[model samples]
Target chain A: MSMERAIGFVVGIVAAAVLALIARKIVARRGGATGEYDERQQVVRGRAFTLAYAVIMVYLAVWMVLRNVELPFFNHPSSVLVGILLSVTVFVGYSVFNDAYFRTSDRPGTYIALIGAVGLLNLILGIRHWVRETTLEGRLLDNANLMVAAMMIAVMACVVIKLALDRRSEAN
Target chain B: MKNLKLKSARAGRDMSQQQLADAVGVSRQTINAIEKGDYNPTIRLCLAICKALGKTLDELFWPEEP
Candidate 1:
Protein backbone atom coordinates (compact mmCIF):
# COMPACT_ATOMS: atom_id res chain seq x y z
CA MET A 1 0.00 0.00 0.00
CA SER A 2 2.92 2.35 0.76
CA MET A 3 4.87 3.88 -2.10
CA GLU A 4 8.07 2.04 -1.30
CA ARG A 5 6.38 -1.36 -1.06
CA ALA A 6 4.33 -0.70 -4.20
CA ILE A 7 7.52 0.06 -6.13
CA GLY A 8 9.18 -2.95 -4.55
CA PHE A 9 6.27 -5.11 -5.67
CA VAL A 10 6.69 -3.84 -9.21
CA VAL A 11 10.40 -4.61 -9.07
CA GLY A 12 9.67 -8.08 -7.73
CA ILE A 13 7.32 -8.69 -10.64
CA VAL A 14 9.99 -7.60 -13.11
CA ALA A 15 12.60 -9.81 -11.49
CA ALA A 16 10.19 -12.70 -11.61
CA ALA A 17 9.61 -12.02 -15.27
CA VAL A 18 13.29 -12.45 -15.93
CA LEU A 19 13.28 -15.67 -13.95
CA ALA A 20 10.23 -16.92 -15.80
CA LEU A 21 11.90 -16.21 -19.11
CA ILE A 22 14.77 -18.49 -18.18
CA ALA A 23 12.44 -21.10 -16.70
CA ARG A 24 10.22 -21.18 -19.74
CA LYS A 25 13.18 -21.64 -22.03
CA ILE A 26 14.43 -24.43 -19.86
CA VAL A 27 11.13 -26.26 -19.79
CA ALA A 28 10.73 -25.90 -23.52
CA ARG A 29 14.27 -27.13 -24.11
CA ARG A 30 13.78 -30.09 -21.80
CA GLY A 31 10.47 -31.05 -23.40
CA GLY A 32 8.57 -30.63 -20.13
CA ALA A 33 11.11 -32.19 -17.82
CA THR A 34 10.58 -31.13 -14.21
CA GLY A 35 13.38 -32.58 -12.11
CA GLU A 36 16.27 -31.99 -14.43
CA TYR A 37 18.99 -31.91 -11.83
CA ASP A 38 21.63 -34.58 -11.96
CA GLU A 39 23.52 -35.77 -8.87
CA ARG A 40 26.30 -33.24 -9.35
CA GLN A 41 23.87 -30.35 -9.62
CA GLN A 42 21.93 -31.55 -6.63
CA VAL A 43 25.07 -31.57 -4.53
CA VAL A 44 26.02 -28.10 -5.67
CA ARG A 45 22.56 -26.78 -4.86
CA GLY A 46 22.62 -28.40 -1.46
CA ARG A 47 25.93 -26.80 -0.67
CA ALA A 48 24.73 -23.46 -1.97
CA PHE A 49 21.67 -23.46 0.26
CA THR A 50 23.83 -24.34 3.22
CA LEU A 51 26.14 -21.45 2.50
CA ALA A 52 23.22 -19.09 2.07
CA TYR A 53 21.87 -20.07 5.45
CA ALA A 54 25.26 -19.47 6.99
CA VAL A 55 25.47 -16.04 5.39
CA ILE A 56 22.15 -14.99 6.87
CA MET A 57 23.13 -16.11 10.36
CA VAL A 58 26.50 -14.48 10.19
CA TYR A 59 25.07 -11.24 8.84
CA LEU A 60 22.54 -11.03 11.62
CA ALA A 61 25.23 -11.76 14.17
CA VAL A 62 27.34 -8.91 12.87
CA TRP A 63 24.43 -6.52 12.92
CA MET A 64 23.70 -7.45 16.51
CA VAL A 65 27.29 -6.84 17.44
CA LEU A 66 27.26 -3.43 15.76
CA ARG A 67 24.14 -2.42 17.62
CA ASN A 68 25.49 -3.68 20.94
CA VAL A 69 28.71 -1.72 20.49
CA GLU A 70 26.61 1.45 20.07
CA LEU A 71 27.89 2.23 16.63
CA PRO A 72 26.18 5.39 15.40
CA PHE A 73 25.00 3.81 12.17
CA PHE A 74 24.12 0.50 13.77
CA ASN A 75 20.41 1.06 14.04
CA HIS A 76 17.05 -0.32 12.92
CA PRO A 77 15.38 -3.71 13.05
CA SER A 78 16.51 -5.07 9.69
CA SER A 79 16.70 -8.70 10.64
CA VAL A 80 13.91 -10.00 8.43
CA LEU A 81 14.37 -8.01 5.24
CA VAL A 82 18.15 -7.83 4.78
CA GLY A 83 18.52 -11.38 5.99
CA ILE A 84 16.16 -12.56 3.29
CA LEU A 85 17.92 -10.55 0.60
CA LEU A 86 21.47 -11.72 1.34
CA SER A 87 20.26 -15.30 1.72
CA VAL A 88 18.72 -15.23 -1.74
CA THR A 89 21.93 -13.81 -3.17
CA VAL A 90 23.89 -16.79 -1.96
CA PHE A 91 21.58 -19.23 -3.69
CA VAL A 92 21.32 -17.29 -6.94
CA GLY A 93 25.03 -16.57 -7.09
CA TYR A 94 25.95 -20.18 -6.43
CA SER A 95 23.45 -21.63 -8.87
CA VAL A 96 24.29 -19.21 -11.64
CA PHE A 97 28.00 -19.82 -11.24
CA ASN A 98 27.62 -23.59 -11.27
CA ASP A 99 25.73 -23.61 -14.59
CA ALA A 100 22.78 -25.20 -12.84
CA TYR A 101 20.07 -22.54 -12.34
CA PHE A 102 19.42 -21.19 -15.83
CA ARG A 103 19.22 -24.55 -17.55
CA THR A 104 20.42 -22.62 -20.55
CA SER A 105 24.04 -22.28 -21.65
CA ASP A 106 26.76 -20.58 -19.63
CA ARG A 107 26.15 -17.45 -21.70
CA PRO A 108 24.53 -15.64 -18.77
CA GLY A 109 25.19 -12.15 -20.03
CA THR A 110 21.61 -11.12 -20.77
CA TYR A 111 20.02 -12.36 -17.56
CA ILE A 112 22.76 -10.92 -15.44
CA ALA A 113 22.56 -7.60 -17.22
CA LEU A 114 18.83 -7.42 -16.78
CA ILE A 115 19.08 -8.12 -13.07
CA GLY A 116 21.93 -5.67 -12.64
CA ALA A 117 20.16 -2.84 -14.39
CA VAL A 118 16.99 -3.30 -12.39
CA GLY A 119 18.95 -3.62 -9.17
CA LEU A 120 20.69 -0.29 -9.77
CA LEU A 121 17.38 1.39 -10.33
CA ASN A 122 16.09 -0.02 -7.06
CA LEU A 123 19.18 1.15 -5.23
CA ILE A 124 18.65 4.69 -6.48
CA LEU A 125 15.02 4.60 -5.48
CA GLY A 126 15.94 3.39 -2.01
CA ILE A 127 18.36 6.24 -1.55
CA ARG A 128 15.70 8.72 -2.62
CA HIS A 129 13.28 7.21 -0.11
CA TRP A 130 15.91 7.37 2.61
CA VAL A 131 16.51 11.07 1.92
CA ARG A 132 12.80 11.83 2.36
CA GLU A 133 12.18 9.71 5.47
CA THR A 134 11.93 11.61 8.82
CA THR A 135 12.08 8.71 11.28
CA LEU A 136 15.17 6.70 12.15
CA GLU A 137 13.41 3.36 11.64
CA GLY A 138 12.03 4.47 8.26
CA ARG A 139 15.49 5.59 7.13
CA LEU A 140 17.00 2.36 8.29
CA LEU A 141 14.41 0.32 6.48
CA ASP A 142 15.13 2.27 3.32
CA ASN A 143 18.80 1.46 3.74
CA ALA A 144 17.90 -2.21 4.13
CA ASN A 145 16.06 -2.03 0.84
CA LEU A 146 19.16 -0.46 -0.67
CA MET A 147 21.04 -3.45 0.68
CA VAL A 148 18.65 -5.68 -1.18
CA ALA A 149 19.78 -3.97 -4.35
CA ALA A 150 23.39 -4.43 -3.35
CA MET A 151 22.74 -8.09 -2.68
CA MET A 152 21.42 -8.54 -6.18
CA ILE A 153 24.47 -6.84 -7.65
CA ALA A 154 26.70 -8.93 -5.41
CA VAL A 155 25.11 -12.13 -6.65
CA MET A 156 25.68 -11.10 -10.24
CA ALA A 157 29.30 -10.24 -9.51
CA CYS A 158 29.89 -13.59 -7.84
CA VAL A 159 28.44 -15.41 -10.80
CA VAL A 160 30.67 -13.54 -13.22
CA ILE A 161 33.70 -14.26 -11.09
CA LYS A 162 32.84 -17.94 -10.89
CA LEU A 163 32.38 -18.16 -14.63
CA ALA A 164 35.73 -16.48 -15.23
CA LEU A 165 37.52 -18.78 -12.84
CA ASP A 166 35.97 -21.86 -14.36
CA ARG A 167 36.95 -20.74 -17.83
CA ARG A 168 40.54 -20.07 -16.77
CA SER A 169 40.79 -23.45 -15.08
CA GLU A 170 39.60 -25.09 -18.26
CA ALA A 171 42.25 -23.27 -20.28
CA ASN A 172 44.94 -24.49 -17.90
CA MET B 1 38.59 -40.72 -15.26
CA LYS B 2 36.78 -39.74 -18.44
CA ASN B 3 33.97 -41.78 -19.92
CA LEU B 4 36.30 -42.77 -22.71
CA LYS B 5 33.80 -45.24 -24.18
CA LEU B 6 31.12 -42.61 -24.46
CA LYS B 7 33.59 -40.21 -26.01
CA SER B 8 34.80 -42.91 -28.42
CA ALA B 9 31.30 -43.85 -29.49
CA ARG B 10 30.35 -40.23 -29.94
CA ALA B 11 33.44 -39.67 -32.06
CA GLY B 12 32.79 -42.80 -34.11
CA ARG B 13 29.27 -41.58 -34.77
CA ASP B 14 30.78 -38.25 -35.75
CA MET B 15 28.54 -36.37 -33.38
CA SER B 16 29.44 -33.11 -31.67
CA GLN B 17 28.86 -32.70 -27.95
CA GLN B 18 26.00 -30.40 -28.81
CA GLN B 19 24.48 -33.00 -31.11
CA LEU B 20 24.56 -35.74 -28.50
CA ALA B 21 23.28 -33.35 -25.82
CA ASP B 22 20.40 -32.34 -28.07
CA ALA B 23 19.57 -35.94 -28.81
CA VAL B 24 19.56 -36.63 -25.10
CA GLY B 25 17.43 -33.53 -24.32
CA VAL B 26 19.98 -31.78 -22.10
CA SER B 27 22.30 -28.79 -22.19
CA ARG B 28 25.66 -29.32 -23.86
CA GLN B 29 27.23 -28.73 -20.47
CA THR B 30 25.52 -31.85 -19.19
CA ILE B 31 27.14 -33.90 -21.89
CA ASN B 32 30.45 -32.25 -21.12
CA ALA B 33 30.02 -33.07 -17.45
CA ILE B 34 29.35 -36.71 -18.22
CA GLU B 35 32.48 -36.89 -20.33
CA LYS B 36 34.58 -35.05 -17.75
CA GLY B 37 33.49 -37.51 -15.05
CA ASP B 38 32.28 -34.57 -12.98
CA TYR B 39 28.69 -35.72 -13.09
CA ASN B 40 26.95 -39.07 -12.93
CA PRO B 41 23.76 -39.15 -14.96
CA THR B 42 20.63 -40.84 -13.79
CA ILE B 43 19.70 -44.32 -15.01
CA ARG B 44 17.09 -42.73 -17.25
CA LEU B 45 19.64 -40.34 -18.72
CA CYS B 46 22.12 -43.15 -19.02
CA LEU B 47 19.63 -45.18 -21.08
CA ALA B 48 18.88 -42.15 -23.19
CA ILE B 49 22.57 -41.53 -23.88
CA CYS B 50 23.15 -45.19 -24.69
CA LYS B 51 20.24 -45.23 -27.09
CA ALA B 52 21.38 -42.00 -28.71
CA LEU B 53 24.86 -43.40 -29.35
CA GLY B 54 23.64 -46.90 -30.32
CA LYS B 55 25.59 -48.41 -27.43
CA THR B 56 24.65 -50.48 -24.39
CA LEU B 57 24.83 -49.22 -20.80
CA ASP B 58 27.71 -51.48 -19.88
CA GLU B 59 29.76 -50.48 -22.86
CA LEU B 60 29.32 -46.78 -22.23
CA PHE B 61 29.23 -46.61 -18.44
CA TRP B 62 30.80 -49.70 -16.89
CA PRO B 63 34.35 -49.40 -15.63
CA GLU B 64 36.80 -51.75 -17.29
CA GLU B 65 38.62 -54.09 -14.91
CA PRO B 66 42.31 -53.19 -14.71
Candidate 2:
Protein backbone atom coordinates (compact mmCIF):
# COMPACT_ATOMS: atom_id res chain seq x y z
CA MET A 1 0.00 0.00 0.00
CA SER A 2 1.09 3.61 -0.50
CA MET A 3 2.60 5.45 2.46
CA GLU A 4 -0.16 8.08 2.32
CA ARG A 5 -2.88 5.39 2.46
CA ALA A 6 -1.09 3.68 5.35
CA ILE A 7 -0.92 6.95 7.24
CA GLY A 8 -4.60 7.63 6.59
CA PHE A 9 -5.49 4.15 7.86
CA VAL A 10 -3.44 4.63 11.01
CA VAL A 11 -5.06 8.00 11.62
CA GLY A 12 -8.50 6.49 11.15
CA ILE A 13 -7.74 3.76 13.69
CA VAL A 14 -6.48 6.25 16.23
CA ALA A 15 -9.48 8.53 15.74
CA ALA A 16 -11.86 5.57 16.16
CA ALA A 17 -10.09 4.53 19.37
CA VAL A 18 -10.29 8.06 20.78
CA LEU A 19 -13.99 8.31 19.88
CA ALA A 20 -14.65 4.99 21.56
CA LEU A 21 -12.97 6.13 24.73
CA ILE A 22 -15.00 9.33 24.72
CA ALA A 23 -18.20 7.36 24.21
CA ARG A 24 -17.35 5.08 27.11
CA LYS A 25 -16.68 8.05 29.30
CA ILE A 26 -19.98 9.64 28.38
CA VAL A 27 -21.87 6.43 29.09
CA ALA A 28 -20.07 6.02 32.40
CA ARG A 29 -20.99 9.53 33.42
CA ARG A 30 -24.60 9.14 32.41
CA GLY A 31 -25.22 5.72 33.92
CA GLY A 32 -22.59 5.44 36.63
CA ALA A 33 -19.78 2.85 36.33
CA THR A 34 -20.10 2.21 32.58
CA GLY A 35 -23.61 0.67 32.89
CA GLU A 36 -23.92 -3.05 33.42
CA TYR A 37 -26.33 -5.39 31.65
CA ASP A 38 -28.44 -7.46 33.99
CA GLU A 39 -28.22 -11.25 33.83
CA ARG A 40 -31.28 -11.68 31.62
CA GLN A 41 -30.06 -8.95 29.30
CA GLN A 42 -26.64 -10.59 29.16
CA VAL A 43 -28.28 -13.84 28.10
CA VAL A 44 -30.39 -12.14 25.47
CA ARG A 45 -27.42 -10.14 24.16
CA GLY A 46 -25.42 -13.35 23.86
CA ARG A 47 -28.17 -14.84 21.71
CA ALA A 48 -28.31 -11.69 19.63
CA PHE A 49 -24.57 -11.84 19.03
CA THR A 50 -24.90 -15.46 17.89
CA LEU A 51 -27.68 -14.54 15.50
CA ALA A 52 -25.71 -11.59 14.12
CA TYR A 53 -22.67 -13.78 13.60
CA ALA A 54 -24.82 -16.18 11.63
CA VAL A 55 -26.12 -13.33 9.53
CA ILE A 56 -22.60 -12.12 8.72
CA MET A 57 -21.55 -15.63 7.74
CA VAL A 58 -24.53 -15.98 5.42
CA TYR A 59 -23.92 -12.53 3.96
CA LEU A 60 -20.28 -13.34 3.24
CA ALA A 61 -21.24 -16.60 1.59
CA VAL A 62 -23.67 -14.76 -0.69
CA TRP A 63 -21.11 -12.06 -1.40
CA MET A 64 -18.58 -14.69 -2.44
CA VAL A 65 -21.05 -16.28 -4.84
CA LEU A 66 -21.93 -12.88 -6.29
CA ARG A 67 -18.26 -12.07 -6.78
CA ASN A 68 -17.75 -15.29 -8.73
CA VAL A 69 -20.73 -14.41 -10.94
CA GLU A 70 -19.25 -10.93 -11.62
CA LEU A 71 -22.38 -9.22 -10.47
CA PRO A 72 -22.55 -5.45 -10.59
CA PHE A 73 -22.78 -4.29 -7.01
CA PHE A 74 -21.03 -2.23 -4.37
CA ASN A 75 -17.22 -2.47 -4.45
CA HIS A 76 -15.44 -5.03 -2.28
CA PRO A 77 -14.83 -2.94 0.83
CA SER A 78 -18.25 -1.34 0.60
CA SER A 79 -19.87 -4.76 0.20
CA VAL A 80 -18.06 -6.06 3.27
CA LEU A 81 -19.13 -2.99 5.23
CA VAL A 82 -22.70 -3.56 4.16
CA GLY A 83 -22.55 -7.07 5.54
CA ILE A 84 -21.20 -5.73 8.83
CA LEU A 85 -23.94 -3.10 8.97
CA LEU A 86 -26.56 -5.75 8.29
CA SER A 87 -25.33 -7.89 11.16
CA VAL A 88 -25.16 -4.91 13.49
CA THR A 89 -28.70 -3.97 12.57
CA VAL A 90 -29.90 -7.46 13.29
CA PHE A 91 -28.18 -7.46 16.67
CA VAL A 92 -29.50 -4.02 17.62
CA GLY A 93 -33.04 -4.76 16.46
CA TYR A 94 -33.16 -8.05 18.34
CA SER A 95 -31.67 -6.54 21.48
CA VAL A 96 -34.11 -3.64 21.41
CA PHE A 97 -37.12 -5.89 21.10
CA ASN A 98 -35.79 -8.23 23.77
CA ASP A 99 -35.15 -5.32 26.16
CA ALA A 100 -31.44 -5.99 26.27
CA TYR A 101 -30.03 -3.06 24.31
CA PHE A 102 -29.92 -0.65 27.26
CA ARG A 103 -28.65 -1.32 30.75
CA THR A 104 -30.61 -0.90 33.97
CA SER A 105 -29.22 2.55 34.72
CA ASP A 106 -29.31 3.80 31.13
CA ARG A 107 -31.77 6.47 30.16
CA PRO A 108 -32.97 5.64 26.67
CA GLY A 109 -33.56 9.31 25.96
CA THR A 110 -29.88 10.11 26.25
CA TYR A 111 -28.94 7.38 23.80
CA ILE A 112 -31.74 8.38 21.48
CA ALA A 113 -30.46 11.94 21.38
CA LEU A 114 -26.90 10.83 20.84
CA ILE A 115 -27.82 8.47 18.02
CA GLY A 116 -29.98 11.12 16.36
CA ALA A 117 -27.17 13.65 16.49
CA VAL A 118 -24.60 11.27 15.05
CA GLY A 119 -26.97 10.09 12.37
CA LEU A 120 -27.71 13.63 11.32
CA LEU A 121 -24.03 14.50 11.20
CA ASN A 122 -23.24 11.50 9.02
CA LEU A 123 -26.21 12.20 6.82
CA ILE A 124 -24.87 15.69 6.14
CA LEU A 125 -21.45 14.37 5.22
CA GLY A 126 -22.99 11.68 3.04
CA ILE A 127 -25.08 14.26 1.27
CA ARG A 128 -22.05 16.44 0.59
CA HIS A 129 -20.19 13.47 -0.92
CA TRP A 130 -23.19 12.52 -3.03
CA VAL A 131 -23.47 16.06 -4.35
CA ARG A 132 -19.83 16.02 -5.41
CA GLU A 133 -20.22 12.75 -7.30
CA THR A 134 -21.11 12.67 -11.00
CA THR A 135 -21.52 9.01 -11.95
CA LEU A 136 -23.24 5.80 -10.82
CA GLU A 137 -19.93 4.04 -10.23
CA GLY A 138 -20.64 2.59 -6.78
CA ARG A 139 -19.62 5.92 -5.29
CA LEU A 140 -22.69 6.03 -3.04
CA LEU A 141 -21.85 2.77 -1.31
CA ASP A 142 -18.22 3.84 -1.03
CA ASN A 143 -19.30 6.73 1.14
CA ALA A 144 -18.94 5.17 4.58
CA ASN A 145 -20.75 8.08 6.17
CA LEU A 146 -23.94 7.16 4.32
CA MET A 147 -23.68 3.59 5.55
CA VAL A 148 -23.10 4.75 9.12
CA ALA A 149 -26.05 7.13 8.85
CA ALA A 150 -28.30 4.38 7.62
CA MET A 151 -27.23 2.07 10.41
CA MET A 152 -27.72 4.74 13.06
CA ILE A 153 -31.14 5.59 11.69
CA ALA A 154 -32.18 1.96 11.77
CA VAL A 155 -30.94 1.58 15.34
CA MET A 156 -32.74 4.74 16.40
CA ALA A 157 -35.94 3.52 14.80
CA CYS A 158 -35.68 0.23 16.63
CA VAL A 159 -35.18 1.99 19.93
CA VAL A 160 -38.09 4.32 19.31
CA ILE A 161 -40.39 1.46 18.40
CA LYS A 162 -39.31 -0.52 21.43
CA LEU A 163 -39.92 2.45 23.68
CA ALA A 164 -43.37 2.92 22.20
CA LEU A 165 -44.19 -0.73 22.67
CA ASP A 166 -43.03 -0.58 26.25
CA ARG A 167 -45.24 2.44 26.85
CA ARG A 168 -48.25 0.68 25.39
CA SER A 169 -47.57 -2.42 27.44
CA GLU A 170 -47.26 -0.32 30.56
CA ALA A 171 -50.56 1.35 29.81
CA ASN A 172 -52.24 -1.99 29.34
CA MET B 1 -47.19 -20.79 33.94
CA LYS B 2 -46.89 -17.22 35.10
CA ASN B 3 -45.16 -16.39 38.33
CA LEU B 4 -48.19 -14.90 40.00
CA LYS B 5 -46.61 -15.58 43.40
CA LEU B 6 -43.71 -13.29 42.67
CA LYS B 7 -45.99 -10.65 41.21
CA SER B 8 -48.21 -10.81 44.29
CA ALA B 9 -45.29 -10.64 46.67
CA ARG B 10 -43.92 -7.59 44.87
CA ALA B 11 -47.36 -6.00 44.84
CA GLY B 12 -47.86 -6.87 48.48
CA ARG B 13 -44.85 -4.75 49.30
CA ASP B 14 -46.47 -1.88 47.35
CA MET B 15 -43.58 -1.95 44.92
CA SER B 16 -43.73 -1.25 41.22
CA GLN B 17 -41.91 -3.59 38.89
CA GLN B 18 -39.23 -0.95 38.35
CA GLN B 19 -38.82 -0.52 42.07
CA LEU B 20 -38.40 -4.23 42.63
CA ALA B 21 -36.03 -4.44 39.68
CA ASP B 22 -33.91 -1.60 41.02
CA ALA B 23 -33.80 -3.22 44.43
CA VAL B 24 -32.82 -6.54 42.86
CA GLY B 25 -30.24 -4.95 40.51
CA VAL B 26 -32.07 -6.02 37.38
CA SER B 27 -33.95 -4.20 34.64
CA ARG B 28 -37.66 -3.56 34.86
CA GLN B 29 -38.14 -5.73 31.80
CA THR B 30 -36.33 -8.58 33.52
CA ILE B 31 -38.72 -8.35 36.43
CA ASN B 32 -41.62 -8.16 34.02
CA ALA B 33 -40.37 -11.18 32.11
CA ILE B 34 -40.11 -13.17 35.32
CA GLU B 35 -43.69 -12.29 36.20
CA LYS B 36 -44.88 -13.15 32.70
CA GLY B 37 -42.97 -16.47 32.60
CA ASP B 38 -41.08 -15.31 29.53
CA TYR B 39 -37.62 -15.53 31.15
CA ASN B 40 -36.36 -17.77 33.87
CA PRO B 41 -33.77 -15.94 35.97
CA THR B 42 -30.75 -17.60 37.54
CA ILE B 43 -30.61 -18.67 41.18
CA ARG B 44 -28.66 -15.57 42.19
CA LEU B 45 -31.32 -13.35 40.66
CA CYS B 46 -34.03 -15.44 42.26
CA LEU B 47 -32.38 -14.93 45.64
CA ALA B 48 -32.04 -11.23 44.95
CA ILE B 49 -35.72 -10.94 44.07
CA CYS B 50 -36.70 -12.99 47.09
CA LYS B 51 -34.64 -10.74 49.31
CA ALA B 52 -36.00 -7.59 47.69
CA LEU B 53 -39.59 -8.73 48.18
CA GLY B 54 -39.02 -10.17 51.62
CA LYS B 55 -40.14 -13.63 50.48
CA THR B 56 -38.60 -17.08 50.46
CA LEU B 57 -37.49 -18.65 47.20
CA ASP B 58 -40.14 -21.35 47.63
CA GLU B 59 -42.81 -18.73 48.04
CA LEU B 60 -41.72 -16.78 44.99
CA PHE B 61 -40.21 -19.30 42.59
CA TRP B 62 -41.09 -22.87 43.61
CA PRO B 63 -43.79 -24.58 41.60
CA GLU B 64 -46.48 -25.90 43.91
CA GLU B 65 -47.30 -29.61 43.55
CA PRO B 66 -50.61 -30.05 41.80
TM-score of chain B of each: 0.97, 0.96
Q: Which runs in model 2 stand beyond 4 Å of their true positions? A: none
lDDT per residue (tens digit) for residues A79-134 in model 2: 89899999999999999999999888778888888799889989999888888888
For candidate 1, lDDT tens digit of each residue in A1-172?
9999899989989988997788557545644434366555667788889999999899889888888887655565565577778789878888777767654433366556666776887788888878999987777654765877888788778877877886897799
DockQ winner: 2
- When summed lDDT is taken over every stretch of 10 residues in candidate 1 chain A, the lowest stretch is A26-35
The DockQ scores of all candidates, in the order shown, are: 0.36, 0.93
Can you give the lDDT of residue B48 in candidate 1? 95
iRMS, model 2 (angstroms): 0.5
lDDT at residue A81 of model 2 (Cα atoms): 88
Clashing residue pairs found in predicted model 2: none
Interface RMSD of 1: 2.8
TM-score of 1: 0.71
